[model samples]
Target: MKILNFHIRGKMAHFRRYYSNSSALSYSVPPRTTLIGLIAGLLGFERDSYYGDFDPEGCRVAVGVCSPQKKLVQTLNLLMIKSSNDLNGSRQHHSQTPTELIIPANIRTGFLDYEVWICHQNNDLINTLHTRLEQKYGYLTQGVSAALGTAQHLGWAESARIVEGEEVAEAQADFFSILPVSNVISLHLSESRHRLRLQKEDMPIHFHPDRTIAGKGNFLINASAAPVNAKVKTAVRLSDERFITWMED
Candidate 1:
C-alpha cells in the first residue's frame, strides 16, 4: 500500500471534545474525523458531504505529535444573541457568556507541529492529494488558511512527501502518534521506563450530520511518555526514524 506523509502546524489548536458543553476541553492530537475534514477541505469538498467518500475500511490515517505537548486554559467571552420580542417590544437582546477554552501553548516560533500519514485503496484521491501537496497548490496554498481543528484556528502544512514503507516490529519509543485501540495486539512498558501511563481518548472516526451518533470511535495514545517495548502485530516503518501502527475500524 502507498502512503502520503505530511507535516502540519498551527499557532494554536483547540480540538473541542464533543461531550464538553460548559467547558471547551481539547484532544491532545487531531482525531480521525478531523483529519478527514482537513483532506476534504483540501480537495474543496463541501461541508459534511465527503464523509462517505472515504470509508474507514478503505482509507486509513494516523497522526503523530511533532512538538512538545503543552496546553493552557483560557476563558472567552462570547455574545449570545436571542431573537424574540420582549414585553417592552424589544426585538433582540444580547448577553455575554464566559466559556473556558483549552488551547495549545504558544512556542517561540508560534507553531505546533504534527505528522500525518494517509493510506487508501483509491488511487485517484491519493494521487490528487499527493500532487497537491507536492505542487503546493489547492489547500496547501496557504498554511494559515488550512484550518486543523476549528475554523478559528488555522494550520499550515510545512512539508509533504510520498513514502512506501516496510512493516517492522514495534520497539520502545515515545509514541507521538494516535493509534486505534482495536489494532493494539500487545503493549508493555519500556526497559528504562519507570511509570506506564497512557491516555485513552474516544474520538469520532466517521461523521454525518443526518446520523444520530455522528460516527464515533475510540483511540489510545501516549501524550508524551515512552511506553515500554511494545509489539504491534501490524506496524509500518515509514522511514529510518519514523514508525506507526495502522489504525483499524
Candidate 2:
C-alpha cells in the first residue's frame, strides 16, 4: 500500500477536546478524526459528506509530533449577541472564556509541526490526494485552505510524497508515532532518561455518516517528537526506517 506523507505546521492550534465544557480545552496532537477531516478538506469534500468514504475499516491514519509543543490558556472576550441588532456590540455582555491553545515549546522556531501518515483502500482516492498534495499541499488546485483546528489559526502542509511501508510483527521495532493505548504493552520511560515527553488522550477515531462520533480511542504519544521505546502491536515500518502504530477501531 502507498501512504501519503506530509507535515503540517502552524503558529497556533486548538483541537478542542471532544467533551469540553465552558472552558475550551485542547488535545496535544490532532486526533485520527481530525486527520480524516483534513484529508476530506484536501479532497474538497463538502461538510459532513465524507464520513463513510473514509471509514476506519478502510482508511488508516497515524500521526507524530515533529516539533516540541506546549499549551497555554488565555481568556477570550466572547460577545453574547442574541439577534442581528446586537451584531455591532450595541448590547454588550462579554463572557471571558478560558481557551487553551497548542504552540511550539520554543518561541523562536515559530511553528508547531505534526507529521501525518495516511492510506486508503480506494486506490483512486489515494492517487487523487497525492496529486492534490503535490500541488503545494492542495491550496491552489482545490482552492481549499488548510488550518490547524480552526480557520483563524491557519496551517500548511509540505513535502507531500507517496511512500511504501511493510507490515511488521508485533514489537518488531520501537514506535515513533502515536500508539493506541490498547496496543501498548510497555513503555520504556526510564531508558529515555527524562527526555521523552509522553501524554495520554481520549480522541475520536471515527464518525457515522450522520455526523455522530462512532468510535473513540485512547492513545499514547510523545509530544517532543522523539522516539519512544515500547512494545506495541500493529506496527508498520516505513521505508525511511520509521515505525508507526495504526489508529485501529
- CA lDDT, every model vs. true structure: 0.67, 0.83
- For model 2 the TM-score comes to 0.92
C-alpha RMSD (angstroms) for model 2: 2.2
* Model 2: CA > 4 A from native: 80-91, 136-138, 141-143
In model 1, the worst 10-residue window by lDDT is 95-104
Q: Tens digits of per-residue lDDT for model 2 on 1-249? A: 688898888889999898999999999988888888888888888878999888888899988888888889999887788998877877767888999999898867668988889989998998888777777424443555668996778888887889898887667456778889998877777665436778899999988887688999898878877878777766888989888888882
Model 2 lDDT, residue 64, Cα: 89
Give the winner by lDDT: 2
TM-score of each: 0.78, 0.92
Candidate 2 lDDT (Cα, whole model)? 0.83
Error of 1 at 55 (Å): 1.0
**C-alpha-based local distance difference test score of model 1:** 0.67
- Name the 10 consecutive residues with the lowest summed lDDT in model 2: 136-145
